[model samples]
Target: MDSQHPPSPDSEQQTTSRKRRGIGRIGWAVLGTVFFGSLLLIGILPRLSQRSELQAAVKEASTIPSVDVITPRRAAATTNLELPGSVVPLNQTTIYARSTGYLRRWYADIGDRVRAGQLLAEIDSPDTDQQVLQAKAELAQAQANILQSRASLAKSVSDLKQARANLLIARQSWERWQVLVKQGAVPQQDADTKYATYQANLASVEAAQNTVNSDSANVKAAQASAYASQANFQRNTVLQSYKKVTAPFSGIITARNVNTGVLITAGSGNSNTSSSTSNTSLYTIAAYDTLDVNVNVPQSSSGILETGQTAQITVRELPQRVFRGKVVRTSNAIDPNTRTLLTQLEIQNSDGVLRPGMYASVKFAINRTNAPFVIPDSALVVNAGGTQVATITKDQTVHYQKVAVGRDYGTEVEITSGLTGNESLIATPTVDETEGLRVQPIAQTK
Candidate 1:
């Protein structure tokens, strides 16, 4: 009641002044609170916004995968081309019998060294020997017949002379008899008788001349028969010489198919004359002084190929050794079916260490004109657009880089044309990776 009592004019004025001062203090406090709150909001709002932006940036960075990046390297000035080939000899031939006979003895066996004209085997050909003797006898008989015919020809010439003499005498007598008959120097019956005698002499001369002509024809027929017999004798003699089988050329005997007692036919190994191979080859000889390799060079490497070019040859059997050789000859034509060039390379195997028919690998040294950049094989990618590689930009975005590739090394490839050496390429890009995809590029270690 005392706190709520009505005030006198002086006291009431004092109370009102006190209440106004209190309200003023309360208003000042409210103003200070509002000002401080405004300052705090102005200071903290920008920091909160900055914190949100940093968090968003961190999230964006985590979304991208870190990838290894590589740069291209220069290729070598020279390149090696490897291909498969087979070994062969300079000359090889299968021996055959020139005359049908039974093999008597073989001086040369498999792996035996022989010289040209050396006896390789002997044949027992009793039939050929008897045939030769018969041919000689026939030749001698023909020669005797020719001599007898020549004597007849001599007689024919003598007869021809006699006939001519008789003809002259008969013609003169015929003229004489006609003259005497016309002159009536003798009796008519006597002159007629002389004319008849002259006519008979003329007929005798004609008969002798016909006999000479027949003898000449006989001589010619005998000479022709003698010539034919001589030819047969010469052929038989040549056949007899073939009983001793001699090496046509110096070489090593690679095979001996005929035993000492096997029967071999004539022309059995002549590729053109004989198709019957039922008789095995008497001998197989090969000249291995120089080893030859036959290889099919790819068509793509034809432009750089040349005769007499050097090459390197190796075989699995001779792993530690290498054979140096040169290009001997080429078919000069690309095989359309295989798309390769048939080439022959020769190597001097004087030591005889290399044998024919060995499987070999050949290497050809090639000079590269425009050596391309070498890149990791894993960097290449293929898609609908063709072969390309994934490259990273400055902003960590992947870009598709089209590239032309050449020869392939096992883990690397040659880039013929495309990027400079400065591009950062993804070493291993997944199939899902594509152009414009974000990535984190990390430098690759060697």
Candidate 2:
């Protein structure tokens, strides 16, 4: 019975007391509410203040000034126009073989100076030699025939004289017989016999005359044949002389195509001969002391060019030197396809410095006093209105000006109809700026 009432030991009595305690719970809830409310108020108030300051700063940045730029104008010296061309020999000749023969020996070669009629090479013409021998033999035979005909003609003439004497004697005998027949001292038969003898002698004289005529005709034929053979012999001799190739003019041999033992053919469409060595020319001579430069100038530049005008030439091989020359000739007509004028300049190359086939640059100093105002090409601005430039006014304002331009010199341009040359020009203008724009300029540094 004592334990069933409630065994309230010391630990059990303390637990019951704690379960009955609830007063501090309301105080803790009130403290948490006050802490959270203070945090909300502190965070929101500073953000609202910062937002207004940021707006004020943005407004201030909007009033900042723009950057300024400046440039200067300069006067440039007049320049000449430079063009490109090639060098060529003023007088060039190609040497060709006139007769074909085996090359025996070459006396001249490339770079060898030769005089007119100088021996260039020698040809072994065995065929031509044989022709000469044959012609000589024919001529001798013809002369022998002529001698035989003359002998025959002399014999015929002697026979004709004997026949004439016999005819005269027979005629005298016939007349004596006729007188004797009239005087009865001769028989008729005798007279008839004498008359027959005279007739026979006359016939013999006619036969001798015909023989002489035949001999004379034969002599004439032999003489003609001899003349023909002589002509052939002379032609062969002349052709044999051609075997030694001679220089046509005084010049330097620029080429040689023949060597020893090479076969050369006659020039009349016969290819039976072959050269002993490949790439051998008979001779090629040229006078390199004088040279010509051919230049193709644009049609627009053709009008100002004239014969006898001085030209300055620069060869690529001789870079450090310039050659002085004069215009020798011009085509006088423009080429339709290239739209250019073909001009030639003659240069004296006596020092052998300027060679043919060298590339060259020619400078033409054209007087362009009639040309318009010129400016730096950098000042031009290309847009929808053709070409324009930015000009600075006296009041420090910029103007976008339209201009008509001409020949361009890479870094400069010619103003054909647009500028007065007195105004200041800007080399480059900003895209955001336009006509009548106000600016504060700072001088440009070089």
Best by lDDT: 1
What is the lDDT of every predicted structure here?
0.85, 0.78
Candidate 1: C-alpha RMSD after superposition: 10.2
Across 1-446, the per-residue lDDT of candidate 1 in tens digits comes to 35776667999899999999999999999999999999999999999999999999989879888889998888888999899999999999988788887778879888998999999988888888998999899889988988888888788778778777876776777678778878987667766776677677677677777877888788888888889889999898899999999998888999877766666688763222123344546788999888799999888678788888999999999899999989989999999999999999999888888899999999999888877899989999988888898999888899999998887888999898888888999999997677798888889999
lDDT of 2 by residue, 1-446 (tens): 45556556987988877766654676788899999999989998898889888888666645532323334333334457678888887766655555566677879877887888898777787888999999999999999999999999999999999999999999999999999999999899999999999999999999999999999999999999999999999999888888877887776887666556666655421122352433334566776788889999887678888899888999777889989889999999999999999999898888878766788999977776556677767778898877988877887778877888766778877776667767666766667557786655454555
Candidate 2 whole-model C-alpha lDDT, 0 to 1: 0.78
**RMSD list, candidates in order:** 10.2, 23.7
**159: Cα error in model 1, Å:** 1.7
Evaluate residue 168 in candidate 1 and report its C-alpha lDDT on the 0 to 100 scale: 78
- lDDT assessment of candidate 1: 0.85
TM-score of each: 0.71, 0.55
